[model samples]
Target: MSLTPSSSTAPAAADPLTPLLTELESALGSVQAALSQRDALALERHAASVQRLMTDALREGRERGRGGDLTPALRQRLAAAGAQVAAQRAALGRATAALDRAIDVLMPPEPLGLYGQSGRTLRQRSSGDVASA
Candidate 1:
């Protein structure tokens, strides 16, 4: 195997871990991009978004009936994968919720105006003119 570096993409002149960190940051950015508008913990993917992706996969596998001899093993793998997916989904929820809460705290709602006060209708500032909400 040739050890020569590829010429198309040059490496940055920084610590080795720097590139790793940058890659991680980019990955995090991508994950953040996947987040829903109202939630930082929740991801919205249309292609194949599922809390139990493996369960769905296993279901599909069984529907297809592709294998006969490996059924037991397949079921076992499916169960294990389902468990892991469940754990990961729960973890993902917690992490995303925490991120949402952090963001909420960091970007609290702007102070409410007179209309912002709960149950109060909007009125002209000095009551000299008619106002609308």
Candidate 2:
């Protein structure tokens, strides 16, 4: 065999976490977009995707003998994603509270004495006499 170096370019080995991180970032972006648009169906789908990705990541970590310990890059990405989710949750909570306040103002609840124990509003009877004595 000749000892001369070959001129052909060889592909480098890829980091196993690269694809998982990429897909996770994509799913996170989709989730954020769905939240912004208030699309429940899209949100559900993307959220499931995110959950699946997380499960896969956990499995990968275990398989790699890391026992749930991730590389710095993976940890950073996950932390950012977690912060994004938390911010989204806070925004949603604020919006829901605002809507609840508006609804309360528009449709005030009955007073304590107005509603029966069973929770239905008691109907007021007419003052007019219904029958002669």
Candidate 3:
């Protein structure tokens, strides 16, 4: 037989994860956008969509008997997304801490009194009264 491509061989099927990965990428980008815009409702909605997409992707992978066996490029993209989320979270945390510090400085807490209450009595007493003693 001549060394040539066989007509009987069919083309490889497209990867099932491609669409899921694409959707996930879009959702992650939306989440980042919402974060940057400080849009709580949009952020929450996109975050939930991201979570659902991850679950669906996991289910698809497991169904295909390829649990956690993602291609290198896909894994790299996931890692980058995770790093981006982590960086955003860290920045938010730092901002919150700074705000807390600023608020504390602006409105200091009241100091505790010696008797654990304000330095005042409800009733005054005369010196010779037994209640005064």
Candidate 4:
């Protein structure tokens, strides 16, 4: 009797990097959410996770390439995810800059020195002395 298993009975091989890509996508989504909510803690946590996942994904991709298994679709997905992450980062930077400007306007910087070089206290003058009115 034959002992070979049929194709229907054999399990399909899974792509090693698919899970990592999915995880990276999830982390990116979390980062976006954290940014929108202005939650620094969550943003930091998710950003770190995304970095780790990206490193792992790159390693896996290289391995797959060596094995001649890397697909174009996978590459496209990775590129798209990277673009999204970059966009989110830019948006966060702009928002932080705007916030800093607003804070600066609300609370101006203090003067470094209160006295002038002539041994006189520097003060804002209400009127200036001039020859003509």
Best by the TM-score measure: 4
Per-model CA lDDT versus the true structure:
0.46, 0.66, 0.65, 0.75
What ranking emerges by lDDT with the best candidate at the front? 4, 2, 3, 1
Q: Could you give candidate 2's per-residue lDDT for residues 104-131 as a string of tens digits?
A: 5765655667665434332223112235
Each candidate: RMSD: 15.5, 11.0, 13.1, 11.4
TM match of model 1 to true structure: 0.39
List runs of model 2 lying over 4 Å from the truth. 1-16, 58-70, 120-133
Per-residue C-alpha lDDT of model 3 across residues 1-133, encoded as one tens digit per residue = 3333442232213566667868887998898898789888998899899888877766665565465446677666656656766776787688678866775576444455643343223112221234653
RMSD of 3: 13.1
Candidate 1 Cα errors over 4 Å, as ranges = 1-56, 64-70, 114-133
After superposition, candidate 4 runs with Cα above 4 Å error: 1-12, 115-133
**Where in model 3 is the C-alpha error above 4 Å?**
1-14, 58-69, 113-133
The candidate with the higher lDDT, 1 or 2, is: 2
User: Lowest summed lDDT over 10 consecutive residues: which window, candidate 1?
Assistant: 121-130
